[model samples]
Target: MIGPETPRRTVLRSALAATGTAALGVALAACGDKDSLSEQANSGSDKGYIAGDGVVTQLPPSKRGHPVEAGGKLLNGKHFDLADWRGNILVLNLWYAACPPCRKEAKDVEAAYRAYKDKGVRFLGVNVRDGAAAAKSYMRTFDITYPVMLDTAGRVVSALHGVLPPEATPSTLLLDPKGRIAGRVVGEVDKTTLKGMIGDLRT
Candidate 1:
């Protein structure tokens, strides 16, 4: 006694039916209800995080507002100044240690960083939550080498609010060489999609 599977249901089921940690991460991303990080934190549900539905938004040069500016102390106790990397393409990722999508995409992000780090591209991670210990542990676990700005005081968040809202736990913003936001992915960024975005910025 089983029910028929609708086509939409079949697709969703297939996506969720994959095996391993990646599949679990995709399932979690598809289940997020609340969009705001602050709202999720105060909901008392103790869910720790909410995943995004994987939305990518791009801004044309005319529509991309002023150059974004944000700087703060990194986990390594070194002061990071975004102004220092002004003439290079930059990727800014917002994440917290406990966010599943963040963990899911860590490898891809790191791989991308390694691939583009030497080609006039820079990647900066902004840990919106978690203190030094947890944030450092997450980076170690993921073998991440990119410098991450520890956003304990939310200065990074406030500065980049124009492009990246507090909606997605693992959002990524791609900035042009001049530091204006060119594109953003509001979820676990697929490696190919991220690469494409970066490639587009270079043109």
Candidate 2:
């Protein structure tokens, strides 16, 4: 009997099974076909998780939700407090070492971080499902210097559930200078799009 405590991947499989083939097709169609994530979702393989399509959603200031308050321990065991980055635009990326989309976008994400590091734009990775060693290795592989919060138990996910649930690995959230969610990229992010999103928040 799969319950609430069951792993998300198992839950996904169970849900898909219960939905039947026709419903699965409809669900895949709703996710769109342009992005790699959607393609992977339709591949009928357990290796690929159902990440969001490459849709970028921006919320205007009036419609923006409450400020995000979340924190966790980094892989290096340093404490991270989102409140400390209140005055800066923060990019929170949810990812893990095994996810292909996460691996694909790592370099671009790192590049964006480096490009905006001096402009009051901070990038933090919320490693959702990887162990410390694997997450550290992923960072090393991509030369990602940004701090990644080790969120093995999904604490950060629960904290930001009101704004953006960490349902999809490789999701990116762009928070405005005031610590409120300004935008979201629901799949592997492109460098140009990420830079533009940060630029908009910076200005």
Candidate 3:
């Protein structure tokens, strides 16, 4: 919570927390008024990145979680297409090795993963600002076994919303099998609270 961490150094290091978008207008205004609809008709079968059909099943713009980019790569060099994770419950967290709060939440995240991973759940980690080495060390020390993507440039964080410093580290986002956000822990991981939320999601 010291000051804004630069996107170059560390996305998570910027002391940013979930500010949540104020409105889609401000969020989308920068794009100007481009009628993507017109492009779809002209292209016939849309396949390009900027085509109107580029978006599939838009998941109510996430004010907290990532925008679910086209292609995300894991630390292990695996690929995660957002569409593929649709059928399994996904747990997402933004963390950094230096954040004290993130360190505290690591154990809880590991415990939850251990408990629910085999029960039709998937966990994804976004390590911003830190490299594979730091992430590996942290994972090793904390016993985290889930697959995580290294967010070298913090694109995922930017997609969530501009973070504010003193923001809670280890922020959590729980998504249903359908990929919609079911719950979030914006400030630290409260197992009692998270577990209760998880119980609700199952119901």
lDDT, residue 168, model 1: 51
Instruction: Evaluate model 2: give its lDDT.
Output: 0.64
Q: What lDDT tens digits, residue by residue, belong to model 2 across residues 113-141?
A: 99889888898898878888898898889
Q: Candidate 3 on 48-143: residue-level lDDT in tens?
A: 111012111112233223233235678888877756777777778778787766776688888888888887788888786689999999999898
Over 4 Å off, model 3: 1-70, 162-168
- What are the RMSD figures for all models against the true structure? 11.4, 11.8, 13.8
Give the alpha-carbon lDDT of every model: 0.64, 0.64, 0.54
Model 1: per-residue Cα lDDT over 1-203, one tens digit each:
01132111110111111111111111101112233332333342334344544456656665554566555567778877667888999998888888877888899999999999999999989888889899999999999999887766555544433333444567788888777767766667767778888998888
TM-score, cand. 1 vs. native:
0.73
On TM-score, the stronger of 2 and 3 is 2
Candidate 2, superposed: residue stretches over 4 Å from native = 1-48, 159-166
Clashing pairs in 2: none
